[model samples]
Target: MEKPLLVTDFLDRARRYYGDREAIVATTGDRYTYDEFGARADGFAAALADRGIEKGDRVAVLDPNTHYHLEAAYGIMQLGAVHTPLNYRLVPDDFEYILEDAGVDAIYADYEHAEKIEAVRDEVPTETFVTNDTDAVDGDWESFDELVDTDETFERPKMDENDVITINYTSGTTGDPKGVCRTHRTETLHAYIVSLHQEIRDDDVYLWTLPMFHVNGWGHIFAVTGMGATHVCTRGVDAGGIFEAIRTEDVTYLCGAPTVLNMLVDYYERHDVATTGDRDVRIATAGSAPPEAVIRAVEDDFGWYLKHVYGATETGPLITTSDARRFFEDGSDARFAVKKRQGLGYLGTEVRVVDEDGTDVPEDDATLGEVVVRGNQVMDRYWNKPEATEEAFTDRIEGYYHTGDLATVDENGMIAIRDRKKDIIISGGENISSIELEDTLYEHDAVADVAVIPAPSSEWGETPKAFVVPTSGDPDEPGTDVDELVSFTRAHLATYKAVSKVEFVESLPTTATGKVQKYELRQREWDEEDRMIGEG
Candidate 1:
């Protein structure tokens, strides 16, 4: 007999083989077995069916990292429903647009994010709302624990590799968020890529630092779960909390952005954390390329292995990795330097660097070009947006997913990102669009022209900072309120995307063609760093 090639099928096999093994370790010291996790998933599936959720339906989950959230994801996917996770930090307006745009049938929220969803409940098409926390929520909603008490066993829905398993919404670096539709084939293939580079093992204890909503937590939910590794869940990205989890849970592996890694390094240096159960821990970071200094600190100071990777929401989110070489032990700085560049494509992934003319650039590490990829793990399409999806796949490239990232490829085939072709601000791994922020800022009566860019932030890695050339009021007006402009924009846009700092400039530097030179603005802020994109 052959096995079904599906994400849910892998979960069932893990349960059958590693039934007694610990599946999840919560921050509050709660643990669940594979059997318990599987049963909870079954119960949740039955409850969703009871609520009239059918196959191919969309169920949005807005929560922090938790055991129940993981079960909710699996439970929804097992029944052939699309599991969509939302960023809890997004403001109500953002949530309102996404919930309605995605046509979510139901939402399973954490206690912290329940209020935001409640405020806009009537606008969205969501038919049901459930919470992991029971107290003080709406009367209509049901408790997560209560739903999991059902005795009904869920029969796995018959699904093919091409069936859409999840619809991950991008971080909205442009206008309205576009959903990246990924099938079971892509998810399963991405998991294999992660397992190969991340070196997944049955004994590895994985910690959840990255948000589950971010590329299916970098596709580790499938890879780690399939390998039967223990998942240690943390409520927030607290450096102390992470170290404590690593120590107590004996966590061997974790994934995060550069901001998360910097926070841990800073915390370790301040608190002087020596060891985790007499052994060092390992971490994987993505988003912006990490600085060589931070990479060295993770290896030398914190005694943790750090791997740099690059990907986007449309690219199955794991295209390349800068895995450390074993020869770095020979005290060669060159080996460490090579490991800093995002390494070549993972197995089954094809990557290329090409100029605007569609010509492949020489791998001299100086010829900059757009990075594109085609792989088994790449997304199938942008949901309901055929034109946008076609545009993304078209251009000079033939049968490739355009990444819209400007980068340089070295002779060794390692890729170093240079700039973004799109005006996207990546602060702490959250992708924010300059166009979106500028549009909101334009609503201000006092505003004239606005240009936004990624400004360096120690805490957030990069925050949105605005440069404004005021309207015809005054050249040097003392009464110009910057906070007032910021507040006005915050009212329209999400809180995370709001401008943290604003400067009144006489005029922005532009090219001869009359376009704002964002590169010049970014260069001024990031001049001191080795790379324009700060690793933090």
Candidate 2:
């Protein structure tokens, strides 16, 4: 008996097995059981069908983490339409490019962000505009609640596992964001992997700290729902709001980037709040290897376990997790050490750090190579970009997807990312990891946030430079001495790896997901130079 694998099965399972369970706690103070939530999804699906949204139609969803976003995702997929999630942080121009690029036919936007879509609605090919809050919206938009108020049932369309389920756009550091196409099989398999690795249980209560637009909340929407766990939705990530949700909902698990974790830690310290609660909360962090200092604070100060995972938009957005329970149980400093690395390849993923020739690098923990992966969870292709798709998979090893990240494999097969290929600083033939330098600087009490980039230097070709956001001082004026910060890094890292100069900035430019945009900084430094690659 062979049945097709589909992401919709997650919702179906919850509807059947956990109908009476509290399925969602929305920020609007609304609570719904699994039965009610499933019905809403069905109603939304029927409404889309009534509106002539057929199978394979590209439907974009633009919102922060909210109940409407979650229901819209399932409803869109139920109607066999492609779920295209838009980054809420992007501008109207960015939305215009994505809507045009994805050939989106319809959009379901949040009231907070409907104006961005409305501004470009005339330029794109989209014909239908739906919003969760029609009263707040000022354009020709359908009310999401009105549509879902019906008791109509939706017919399940025949779907194959290979059918494209969603189109996730990348952050587009250098150019317009690329649409990463994912299939039902890839998304479902990644959800199972996430469930197993994150230890998601039926009783688990998941807090929506990560944006649902990012890789479908890193596939937690399916993973948590499929496990019959409860979802606590927040409009956005705020320190006080997150703590209140965790305390009120008895949240068991959540995911976020390092920046979010840092914000939570700072809030906890300043307000003298406690992370302890009735249930133990586990957090999964990615978007960069969290500094060891941040990991320690998360575990020790916050009283929560931090699991550092790694992946990209093209790779199901989840490939590795640093559970490292065996090492952490030893009760030594090695516990934090293991949690800091990217850890081993995920259960069904095959990750390898390889050189230019596609040969695996030595597991000596020093050799840097591009990270390539071959797995069912990898995305199928880039939507409407054959040349880019070919370049992503064809140039690398026969069947593996090349991740632009550079990393080193240790003897234990643990993968530690050194830097992105472009972010690596080469000073006098020495390779320096900007991440390592930033991690060391994060340990400083005065440092609030930091980004390390290569600065053009006459003596060493290019040297590491730190962009510092001080905790309690004016960035424009003298607060934290640059010499003191440089000395701090030199004491922890090699002399050459230490930042040669420091630039005090109000804040680092980041993507919507809180990932620092190093390319912008690199462009400023190399605008007058002939090449971006540091002289060796």
Candidate 3:
């Protein structure tokens, strides 16, 4: 009755009960059962132990969605070493910062990305540089295949549930990247909640469309594995490969950001492809709130169920889901509005939309406030940054994690994110939600993707500018023009909310996790301005 909740328990349970079941389908097309996966994890642990790695030592893993990523993760955790995963898309400078900040003793990088680490080998504190393919890489890297063939057994150090087991670095959009420290209990509970909401079944087939480095694939590494599901791995995300995998592997469940949804929709529209096989596919989209038009295309056009969740990296990466079945009784049309909202918080999590004074906002669906949450799944603190940790939890209110995301809660207690606190555009003495403007533009057929940001205006102090990625895939040959899009937005929304300027672009700048980088857009608009913040 008093069993400890350890992240290692997930793999242990799977190996014990679902040992014979397929655990992972490697990017190389090889399959491994849970027994084999567990054995490999043991081998990795032994290899780390042979290199004098002990409990609490930071071990960084930089790779894509591959079998070795999972093996290295659980293997590092088995020895109670802190599992520090790096964003594979990060450059050598970022890698150096994280490796130095975390004081990583060793790093296991994929052959594709190991060169980034080797580029700054002398600057980082990381000593043991191992890669999947030593021959493929330029540096003197050890072969991962040979390392995992260790014959020695590792002694697992005793770990407490509250011990810091993982440290995930933030995207550093605001400032220097701070390491978010999490305990075993936090990850274990977050995995359980994700399993409950995502409705992962043992027979379900999961596709690795999401980056495994992204919050440990948004904690699916444990939730999916613990459920005894089949993992179809991929080196990178491709719409064509995703479709082929679904039709061939019978993928029933997957997760991605709104950008991924847009890519799939664009791909599906240009080509005639079967969306799913015999399995009823469920896709969980987060990183950012999806537009209603995109959500409709995903459900009506692609015939796939979309669950919209919301949270940041420090907040378990998943604290809310929009998969409430009761709201979809009227059919797919009703589900669009419901799924468009971020919906309710997961069980045991307290989510609230609070005003600047730390008071809760009324659920009239009109008032805007910052979202705050408190749960076991939330991160404990920033690694070695106590001041940053204090500011995060005690910003607006004490003890509650301040999300910094502006939102509005409905009558049913479902929260819909309006815009980020810094991204909200104030023009001509009126507050404008950038997300609302983006959603209005997305309804136009010519608009493939769009991002709205505030530009400095002498007339109104600040006015909204639209960056549109058209369907033609050519910025010069965009299917739509400025006057047309402006009039289109004016007809759909209020005059003040309409975009003042429009620019057509081939693509939008996005983070490694696929979230659109709105700050980058803002930086360009305010490059000649005196200050970063715009005046109302």
Candidate 4:
């Protein structure tokens, strides 16, 4: 007999089996057991119910990677309301759009970001606003501390596995942010696969370096807690702070973007710091593939295992991983190549690299195609956009979520994302991968961060342009000149793929999740050319 897979089951099981175990190590140095955490969640659920929040209402959470996020999320989910978590880095305009679009009924923003919501209170439909520190926020908001201390208990509603329990908004890189609707089954299965691949165990200590708002911290909120692991909370991540947490809290595993790994490596190089604690540490990086050099330094120099995974918010945000030990030879240079690719699909996930005509690309590792995926973890649809939903699933395939990521499939069927479909620079009828160019440039010591975008070219239609953030952190005096860097890329890669133009910047603009905002750079480069190209 099979039981219904509800997201609430995770916390229930943890409370039932590991009730007395330490559940969370808060950023404020406060600790909580599973029993206490569960009680707080129940209290928040009661508070929402007291405020007349129904099962189908939408509740938004705006906070960092803190325990409050977990409590508010589970609290909202227990009532079967849609748990809508906002990106903390989003401004008031972005918040207003999402809040109104989702028809959010109530919101819980951290004291640090509550002002953004207050700035747009009249613009959105949301009514109830709560913050952890009401006195600190100059608004008509209630204290979350008081709200979660409700004496009345709430009765959880009967929820189906297929109900849209979460509505995750996209980053709106290309257009308006669309809400990705996901069901309980989708989230639960995603959590299960995350647990299996990340190798989470009860004795493990998970450091919250990743933002909890991002796909629910890539679904670790359920996966890690369900496994009865200790959660070491972090307010924000820095190289020094991350290392200190690892040593002080005995962190064994964590997840972050490639930028976070680079930060840790750079800090480790500049300062002598311990890398691990009492237990061997493992780090999983995604949002983009980490350079093999960073991966090697992480594994060899820092003495930590590195796993490269890939996915998007529309999907489970973790459909593939490069943790296949069979291909990995510990302490061998050959294994870095395998670890660099976004490895095979997770169990029950079908990831395919397909051509424009919807046929699978040859597994020769040279052909580029769009990556599409179909799995139980994939989102059901956009919140209210049927046309957009239809186009997303039926774009190049009938039943798969179009990832819009161009990738190549190797002989072993492991996929490596080359570039985004729009980011692929078409110069003189030749497709130049911006990722390849950026990767080549990353090998240079003068480059601290880099973004490669397609710029209008007089002869080639479009040429690859490089925006380099120097190691010296000054744009005016980039240590290395354009000619030297151009020669460096020419020596490492094909001449056509080399950057035709270079611009030095203080830093590259990135998303809250630490992904370079190449769209911004592309817009700035193409802004004036649009009129000229159109006239031509």
For model 1, the stretches where C-alpha displacement exceeds 4 angstroms are 1-4, 324-327, 472-475, 510-514
- Per-residue CA lDDT of model 1 for 78-137, tens digit only, reads 889999989887888888888888899998998878998999998899988999877867
For each candidate, give its TM-score against the true structure: 0.95, 0.81, 0.81, 0.81
Best by TM-score: 1
Ranking by lDDT: 4, 3, 2, 1
Taken over the whole model, the C-alpha lDDT of each candidate is 0.84, 0.84, 0.85, 0.86
In model 4, residue pairs whose N, Cα or C atoms come closer than 3 Å (at least 3 residues apart or on different chains), thus clashing, are none
Error of 1 at 212 (Å): 0.6
Clash count for candidate 2 is: 0
Error of 4 at 344 (Å): 0.5
lDDT of 3: 0.85
lDDT tens per residue, model 4, 332-438: 88888888788999999999999999999999988889999999999989988999999999999899999888888998899987656655565543346677778
lDDT of 3 by residue, 394-467 (tens): 88888899987788899999998765665566554344667778888999999999999988764454678999
Q: Flag the better candidate by TM-score, 1 or 3.
A: 1
Off by over 4 Å in 3: 423-536
At residue 204, candidate 3 shows an lDDT of 94
Residue 56 lDDT in model 1? 89
Residues 396-442, model 2: lDDT tens digits: 57788888778888888999876566456655434466777788899
Error of 3 at 377 (Å): 0.2
